[model samples]
Target: MDYASLKQKLQAFERQLDATLAALPSRQWASSSALRIASELYEIGAFKNSGTDRAEYLDYGYAILASHFVAGEVGYQADISREADLRQLIADLSFASHYYMIREYLYYSYNVPESMSWSFGEGRVEIRFSDKSIPRQFFTVYNDQMLGSQSHFRNFNHSAEIIRLLENEPEGVVTPNFETADPLMRAEADLKLAAYFSLIAPDSQIDLGGYSYAQFLNVYRMLLTKALYHRYLARAQDAVGAIYMPEGQLLDGIAGELGISLDIGRRILKDLVFDLDAAANRVDATYFSLMREGEPGGRIVMRPHHFATAEGLVNMLRVIAQRRPQTFLDRVSNEIGRAFVQRVKAAWEAEGFTCLSEVSLRDFDPKLPDIDLLVISCEPTLGYIIHVCELKCPVPPRWAKDQLKVLNKDSVSKAFRQVEVLQRFLRTEAGVQFLARVLPKEGHPHFRDFVVALNHLIITSDNAGMFFGAETTRAINFRTLERLLSRSDGDMALIQHILSTYDEHADEALVTTMVEFQLGSLTVAYEGVTASPLLEFPQGSWRSSPDRQAMVDAFIADGAHPFDVLELHPPDVVVNDHSIRVTADEEVPKK
Candidate 1:
């Protein structure tokens, strides 16, 4: 379909989805049912798989929950009683969410093919490509690459280790002011909590749902204790179940533990109970909301699914602790930047490179921006090589919706601009003077006599795939940088080659052309391309394809093998189809 027609079709679909969701029952019931469904799906090993299967299961569950939270704000009678009814609801919501996600990407992406090749009619959309390989390329870019770049839970183990160290700190120490505190000090949960607490004025009573900050913290700790207890009991008994406690006894227990009165404890529990009335129209549901009044009796119920483990409790606490003043947020960001620089410095210094952190030529040239890191290495053939490093700690973008915004802000686009500015300034006469002042005294005299090469690198805490084949500035993940640093001692040649090359190999060792993508009725067929080291291929290796051969030859002429270009950089797959046909009730064509 034409671009305008395509937009109209997608908009109609979105409106229909909204109408369907608006007609659904109360979100509270939907949410509760979604949780139960998720639990069931997990029990059936739906989450144990990986790749497309895993994505499908997660999307299915998330769609049901998200639709209710998004559109079913008004309460109504829930008629979805049978298994088949619930399954159909899930299927409908899943399709809506899944279709919207793909539609948004296709509608808003800057990388969309210039030529139109897609058609839509009778509740189906089909996209065709002139080159068979384009489908695979699309999948590799959207699915495999994007999936591999997700690092949300990757740092849990690291954060857990940090928590372990923080717990060992002596208690009762005065909490330092996070704003003016030393950036080098390891971040402690207690200090972070205190920072958040200080945001509230002493005279003003801040109500988080109902409890005061202190009471909320106490309740949080109590829940964490219960979670830990359940874990321990489960291991000992070789079984898992809810922990039911007499409501009065639970209140009294917490009261004694926190040195509070029973009346106050009761008030806390009353406020903390997951009241569906209070949570209506709110999507910010927490583990605290899982605590419920049990069976009209004087008992409280803590289900196994409610705050499953201590780790989960810690994760929730971390999220809560982050809701601090902007000043505290800035300080935390600075601390993370400092830590990343220290890590990079240590890694490079261990490999015999002169590394500097927070290097700036602003004193000598006010216009020059500060560099996050600087590394200098001497090679027998290349003399002295300097790396101008810019560090960014951006949260990796989500799989859909405003991901491009994240990529543009304080990430790939911003990093590239900063690095380019620094490089431009460094190439000037003033830049040479500043560099001369910073260079080691021993090497200053010989620096001008020998060749000195400058290389720019943008290092991020998380992988950003948008600038994968960028030529002007190299973007690399910190993990990839660490790996390269570790190998530099024995393989400086490979390191140098990577630093100078503008290709996917700069970030990852393996390069593949295999790709696939599937979204609702749309499917991109996969084509497997054998992965091989580009360094092993010679010039004209891909002569069968003139374009590929030209690319290989260009890289070979630039003092590298054809493999370095064709294998690492690979030609962009072009979709040049001009014909479009719409079908009704017809099966989707397969490759």
Candidate 2:
């Protein structure tokens, strides 16, 4: 058959099934609830049949033995649940569920709670079909026009069969949009299933004994949102794999395809290994509480803010000191030392730089104008320093904005181009500095440590070890870029003349270029660390030769500190030098 003809055949076959359901002379579906019961289990989890070691099929229980399973004594369920098999567990759990179409005397059908079902005489029916997931239709149609899918099966062969079946189905009214009409089907299912399992739920079931349908749905929806978020965090990689589905969009995709939220939806995506998920234990639900009140995303605080400037802003700290320093000096030494290491790890990972070795912070100078980050790239190969990163609760901007900028996942071909385009940027001076502030570290304790420890566990040889490289993006530390550049220092001609746009209004000193040499060059080139005649520049906006010359002369002559001086401190009020304070509060307090 031609393509169109094939589609017709499929439609016709569906109609035949619908017709068969309609024509049963006895017409008993409501009481035979096994079909309804079995249908829902497929949506949530797997089921093993009690009658045999084989798994139960939805077709067998939901359709073939619908009446016997839901109403006429589901013996297989009892047999299975007692001993604990998949089929038995499904039967016991699905007992009161609305998924089945049980046969009363004849025609009525009622839906199980989560999906649209109706009372057909005394029977129940659920949204089910063999060809696809409901998302296939729901997503493709409503995707852009969720409301436009009403005519979905108008031309479908099964539509006619369903019409025939419902025609005989007396208790229920013939309708196509029952699901959209009630909209509570899925929520009801979540609640009902949760409640049923609650009896045996390792911990407990969320209660809904006397709640109204609306009430049950409302509470269940929120709980489901949380639970879905949990699922996303739990297995983000599996979640990410779903992005290619027809129904997948940012926020709506998760609920439409997977019946959940997108925040969790994207997290589940394969390309990522969410450190936030790892930072805390799963059962703790730390993300929920952190995010429940405020916005879902976090603010981007520059490095110096938390460690040096805004001490009060950073909180929720869990500090660890292996040994106690009973004396004041001992205490100060112990705490700051531990804290710096912790900060180093957070900073290292925040920017996505992998530590290739246990490069000691012993070489660091806290008094240096900038915090140091060590990596394999860049000059000064003995070490490269990225400025310290401040922890921005929820997430730092380096992590947050880059994450938000992600459009979607691509396969191998696109991945190659993406890696290629990005490497070019990373190789540049601008890109290297950005890497210092932006990337996240992937493998930990560095390559030196991992390789040495590899034989201890025979780890690097395992297939599982390869999985990490595939799943997670290896980190990009500026130091690593620096090292790469150090090797090719002579060949970096492409980037030599091209300058990157730094925020003109920002302080040159505070603006981290990561590399000491690069930053120093910029300062010398600009003459002053802060922008001159700030309003004069508009996108690399500069003055005419005479005007620029005049401005340069003025800047050179201005002795103490040039420019507005407001740009020197992290904030405008604080000045670069103690002598230029406009206000007492802005001055650094004396120790």
Candidate 3:
């Protein structure tokens, strides 16, 4: 179906969902039913049933719920206590979710012909794709690579390491710093201080649904800890039943832990509980409510999935941070940038490089932006290579919809522009003079006449994906930079070589598709083009490059099944002065 037709279909299904939900008895019942269904899905491994995994299913469900129930506030209530009602509700929701999933998939995949052929049957949707399609092939390989990378980098330990680095910075650098090895301990201390700060400046304090940020964090931690304990119990003893703790007991425990009074703890508990009334029809409704007030005994009911894994806890915390007031986040972000720059400066100094942090170019020109970092390295061949490093420690995008925002020009435009300004300045006679003044020339007498090379770099805290081509600036993660530094061992030439040739290496590593077809006697070529290493392509037309079509055709037809997935082999990168070409595409083996 066309875009309009498919959108209409989606809207129709959405209306059906709304009608189904409207027939429910009460909003409370709907919430309970959703929770129950989620639990059942978890227990029966419904997430992993069929080819789709639990994570993907949950992601889709979360998106759908956030859009429909949360945003629209469609109160669909049902008496889940009735067996038949529960069963029918589950079946209805399941079918609606599956249908929505297919429609959403088809809607996004309209650009590719292969994705157009799909069928829904037996409460399941199946999509067929021609293996020859470049978009299909690119997405398959790119998704595998991205998933693997994301899994490795999104670990809690990785975040903890960054937190540790921030905490270790000088007292005035990262405010309310806690010098603790354990992330949880550090988090608690930081929250307490932040809460105190909030109280001191009530006018500027971030609103956490009436409770102080510290109180919110405290209650969340308590709930998460309890949920984790219950999860452990379930796993160890096969106890599938839900555990309810008395409100008084939970408050008492938190009060003791935080050295607060029972009254204060009780207030915090009230703040923490899922206020269905207050949050109704809000997008932030479901996620912020980790605990609900259980009926019959002033007990607390924790969401089963919120704290199921350490990763989940981290994700929830991340969401909370992201959802906070932008002003507060901006302040925190500035501090984080300072902390990261300090870390980078320290690392560079340790490596015996002359590194300048936050070098103000306004002294030279009022309009020029300040450089985050400037490194000067003296090489035997190039004499001196100046590295213009623009440091960015942006919070990685959380949702699937936000993923594309990472590569948006707006995100990195300032950094790129800053670097470009410096590069432009450096090429002038005044720039040479500025460089001569900035460069440490105590050892070398002939520094003035020595050849100089400038390498522009944008280094981030996390992998923001590969940005290649002439227009894009070279961006690398902190880990990669650390590796390069360690391997180079203060060799300027090696660093320059690697930094200069990074784009070429990345391009070789990620294979672009080139298809050839014989239309009668004429040969037509189709070249797959991607604007970024995120594997995003133009919607309407693929680029054409006839030169590589033969190679692609040969590679595909040489006893290798077109559908056989090709794994990305990272270049055997070595840090040295000598120029070397590295490619990551290995020939696929015959099936």
Candidate 4:
């Protein structure tokens, strides 16, 4: 790619975006917040400060594009930082630019239809919008609480404080009132929430049977929660060893005592309350970059174009993250698992054993109850040796919050359950059916012919602080396993011997039901709103408030037109029919 030419085009795009953001009504906090973030990211000084050379600037821009702009919102930054190459970043930038333009068009393009998707140049860029009606159940149970209006502002403002309160203060002591909060604070909160909604959410047009004021509010709230990041809390001295609230009881306490739902309570837990302590290594690299370094004029020198594309790409990433966050997370998980499993499978196959992936235990039932990788070895002299392997890897840092802690426990429980079911099947009539299909083509062997040894293994990318009760499952590091598999030179006996001696250390604390209630000096403060609030209404005016409804009715009774004049009252002026050149871009000007 011609970096210089691309840079110029990017600058042009930035200018266009700036103009569009500036055109949005000031009351539109989301638009303004997005504009601020975009502008901050595009500052030229930040981009060039990393180095004077063109390549250096490109590298910096590439990092920001991958790490901050595109994946930062949904907390998927580290993946890009470690795995993405320059070429991939460029393609992403192009796609993101196109998506950005389409997003802008969705909001600004006039006379929008029910469903539409369009391309600007040779299908290089595309955007599709299909109207989704709110679930009928949603409307039935929907209260203004779901609208999350004031809640968004409250969370944006007091998330850090809320976390602190949850950690230290008794739950009943803190009662948060998102409504009737400071109007100025509310405005600033609105802008931040708005920024996330407009830029990050996949769908902009939400149909609610008919557009109601409440519907708009609810849609914005949903987007805000999706945009919000959840940071995992651990003890101050030990970041990962003893995670805070493994069972999520603290969140439950906060919910019960504070009257906030568990969902909102969870959001408050990870709200960026304070700046990371200099020594803290727990924060995700992507978050560190976006919050501390990625701004254009700061640590990274980025142009407006880069920021624009990042915004668009983040929305694109959000779609992926939203549809299947697990699969999206497994982007790295699968990579780790596949890399290790591929080696193990090849080695075992070379040793004359059958290795399979995604082994289903159910007799063609639903997609669940499947193993990640299963190895079944049958030797005439030896017995049947079955290795049921499941892989668990750490997600990108920000994504590895309290939710991951819960998910890990659930995964282990499910894996254990599946293994048990498989074990039971092996001794019963089901084992015969399973073996007939999965066994090698040699022949079905008698159950008594071989010694059946079943081993369950959990392979991890990192040293996960998982507690295991005296379970037969072995937790082994992927790197260690990869090394072991590599060195085992087609020796199935050596691998089996090593695994047979593998330690199954069980910790009583490993169960998810175990609760640890220790609040350390988290020492993070919620950064206050810096954006200047501009109210749409006149000072002390209630014109926009509900009280204006009665005043409006009175005014209409006195003199004002009560309805649309074109529909309700005929005008004296009439236009004679006249023909003029008509096209998509031009219409005859009215006199």
- Clashing residue pairs for model 3: 21-76, 24-77, 25-77
1-591 in candidate 2: lDDT tens per residue? Answer: 244453454344335444544443223323223222333343223222233222222322223332232233223322212334444534433321111222210111111122212211222212222222111212221121211122222232332332233332222242453323223333433433432211112222222122122332333344343333222222322221101112133236345644545544343321111123322322111111111101124111111101111111111111111111143133233333343345445433443344332222222322222212333222111112222221111111111111222212321223323334433433344433443333234422212111000000000000111111222222222222222223332221211211111111112212211111111112101110111222111222222224645654565465322223323442212111222222213334332
lDDT, candidate 2, equals 0.25
Q: Write the per-residue lDDT of candidate 1 for residues 1-591, one digit (tens) a residue.
A: 465666676576546545654544333454434444433332222323453334343443343344343232333333445666456545544444444444434543234433224455554554433232223223333333333234322332333332333343332133342222212122223322332212232232334333454665666556654544343334333334445567778777787777767776766665444434324523222324243431245244454333432123223322333333353354434544676678777887877778888986777677767888888776433245677888876433333332344345565567777877876676555565555555566653222233345677878654433434434566666655655565455245557665565244322433434233434343433223233332221122121344644664565466642122222322111110112111211222221
What local distance difference test score does each model get?
A: 0.46, 0.25, 0.47, 0.36
Error of 3 at 48 (Å): 8.5
Q: For model 4, how does the per-residue alpha-carbon lDDT over 208-318 read when each residue is reduced to its tens digit?
A: 222222333443333232222111111111111101122156545545544556665443332211112211433322232222232222222223223222322223223
Model 2, C-alpha of 490: deviation from truth (Å): 35
Error of model 1, residue 232, in angstroms: 10
* Predicted candidate 3 versus true structure: per-residue lDDT over 351-375, tens digit per residue: 6688999988786789888888998
**TM-scores for every candidate against the unseen true structure:** 0.55, 0.20, 0.55, 0.32
Q: Is candidate 1 or candidate 2 better by lDDT?
A: 1
Cα TM-score of candidate 1: 0.55
- Ordered by lDDT, highest first, the candidates read 3, 1, 4, 2
Displacement of residue 113 (Cα, Å) in model 1 is: 9.3
